[model samples]
Target: MAGNGSFWVQIMPAILFLQLLFRAVGTDGASSFSFANDCQYPVWVGVLSGATSPPLARSGFYLPPSGTFQLAAPSSGSWSGTFWARTGCAVDSSTGRFSCATADCGSGDVACNGRGPSPPVTLAEITLASPGSGGQDFYDVSLVDGFNVPVRLSPSGGSAGECRAVACAGDVNAACPSDLRVVVAGSGGVVACRSACDAYRSARYCCTGEYGSPAACGPTNYSQVFKTACPAAYSYAYDDASSTFTCVGASNYDVTFCPRT
Candidate 1:
């Protein structure tokens, strides 16, 4: 009986291999063992047996095929991890390697291993403008080499054109000139004023003004004469030569007004 059992055991491997071969090659011995002929028969057979076995899952192992994983950094700053899968002892005889099947598979967990350091966060491009009062300003804020996370702006003192929107968040106070002010004139027209005096106070003089009707503020035309007249109150003038603002008493005052969209 023992001899008979050994014979049956030997026959089982052959029968199983033949069944797999027949399924793969469809009754044709030619295709059934073509891959086997290319390499050593024993090696190829062992590979085939391993390929047919069911895979096992091991604890703490994350293997992804083509994507990045977020693994915990080791004390040495390098990430390292391993994965293991079990199969029948018969298939385990082969030594072929397998790969993970996904990108960023281990990113969800904080403890998994096998990834590089996190990328750096980049700030978005910032722009500032005085759109004159009663008008909307347009700013095209963009991020350079940045991720998809939301960004915010920290304005120093000047108010944003539309602070409720995402684009208005990053306008720092340093970007805007202190002399520039948004003024509301008669008939509800908005004007951008550059003043020699501090315009934040109601008593300051306005050096140059842009926006409003052609008759009142000369719409887009700046005037230095306004600054001369209102040295103590507010004066405004458009400097045709420099294409900017020029205060009557303040020679160095140079401010530009942006058109509102």
Candidate 2:
């Protein structure tokens, strides 16, 4: 079973070690990732290595209607990166090449091949257990780059409270302002929403320049809107303390796209 908590972790050390040693991915084996699609349509899942950490076994792939994608345990070490999905993608009949309408990684294939995806993407930012962070795995859902899909994370093979699931409910994109809205061709239905930082690359919105510090740029109208819509997600860069979550000891995780209602 999986445990969910909203508060920060202050668990005992001994128990924490047990939790870490006994996780699905540990000395027993490497960490693994399970990707599930709960959306009404197909989605292409992409995972990228952060800071060129040990790359994921399958960095990119496709999940058909209600499909699931699995990967072997990751190599032992500190690994951090982002995972997201691409929508409205298909292969060109003549070229037989892969392409996505949104969140395109420019790989021209199912595999991202070390390329970064386009904006308006929902991101599952994660850091696996390492010496620096007391061997805890840190994870979160970030809307800072905008939102293309709804994401949820959970430590599935461990006891409850071991980790908290992060997911945004409801369709905030449909209500997204005209300026920030990403709509489909002709349909005019919302597909994704862009963050102010993404929409306007300025020091104020990017939280850089004189506003580089958290104290400088606390919260803007755009960030507040995102926070109000998805309180558990990283609406801006400084939302860690509240939006970020941790798992002291646990196995692998489940990254769900279009998470359950």
Candidate 3:
């Protein structure tokens, strides 16, 4: 009996090592997103899953200044989604409903419950690769909806070159054009910047009708302003050539709100 006990103890270590090795080799290719709030004020983060993708555990949550939260992607298959931050959020005393000065999801609560954010919001978009597909991950920071906060999306443990960090760390609201600026009452501050499409709603700016194609719709003066402020971000709907980034295999990503320049 004593001899048999020693034999089992010796074999246990070998079994454990094999299990760990198998886990490393058979990774599910799922990724994790780390959300960080670097701003001086608190921000409410909102997430909206793509139509074909599964929703995350919490669609929205409050993140205090310098706070961090991590969420893992679904391991079953590919996932795609967009994340953004809502600023100046507070419960309305009269109505007892939650709202934000910018990028409100209109859920009347802290959780967005799968609702997409309003315009004049900065967006971080990602489409993760499927397991064993050998496909690349696509990510970008888009200002096509507008700019409410500066965001940075950086890949970790991924391939080089195109997997580099992309950010819209510029203060676009301060330099926003008069017609495109969103000013909050009482405070009287330019809290967000509206896109030309959102502000004008014209065929040329909205890229509809005859200007639907990329060839027909080129960068306009309004988009150039956003491009000059944050060159790595998608300034307009067709700003794909320089905005989109790809990574071969990133274990995790850091999405920082109000990221430093």
How would you encode candidate 3's per-residue C-alpha lDDT over 1-261 as one tens digit per residue? 999999999999999999987776555454688999999889999989999999998899999999999998887678899999999999999999999999999999989998999999999999998854657899999999999999999988766565799999999998899999998887568999999999999999988899999999989999999999999999988999999999877888899999976
**Over 4 Å off in model 3, which ranges?**
1-30
Q: Write the per-residue lDDT of candidate 2 for residues 55-120, one digit (tens) a residue.
A: 778879999869998885565667788889999998999999899977999998999989888998
* Each prediction's RMSD to truth: 31.7, 10.5, 3.4
**Cα-based RMSD of candidate 3:** 3.4
Badly placed stretches (over 4 Å) of model 1 are 1-121, 129-141, 148-150, 154-161, 165-261
For candidate 3, the per-residue lDDT at 73 reads: 81
User: What TM-score against the true fold does each predicted structure earn?
Assistant: 0.13, 0.84, 0.89
Reference-based lDDT, residue 10, model 3:
93
Q: Score residue 87 of candidate 3 by CA lDDT.
A: 92
Least accurate 10 contiguous residues by lDDT in model 2: 1-10
Our tally of clashes for model 2 stands at 4
lDDT of 1 by residue, 1-261 (tens): 999999999899999998887676432110010010111111101100122222212122322222122211111111112121111112122543322111112223322233221211111222212112222222221211111112221222223342322221221212223344332344132122232233332221222253332344431112232323222111122222222211111101011111011
Q: Best candidate per lDDT, number?
A: 3
Q: Against the hidden true structure, what lDDT does model 1 obtain? A: 0.22
**C-alpha lDDT score of every prediction, in listed order:** 0.22, 0.80, 0.91
Candidate 2 TM-score, true structure as reference: 0.84
Q: Give, for candidate 1, the lowest lDDT window spanning 10 residues.
A: 28-37
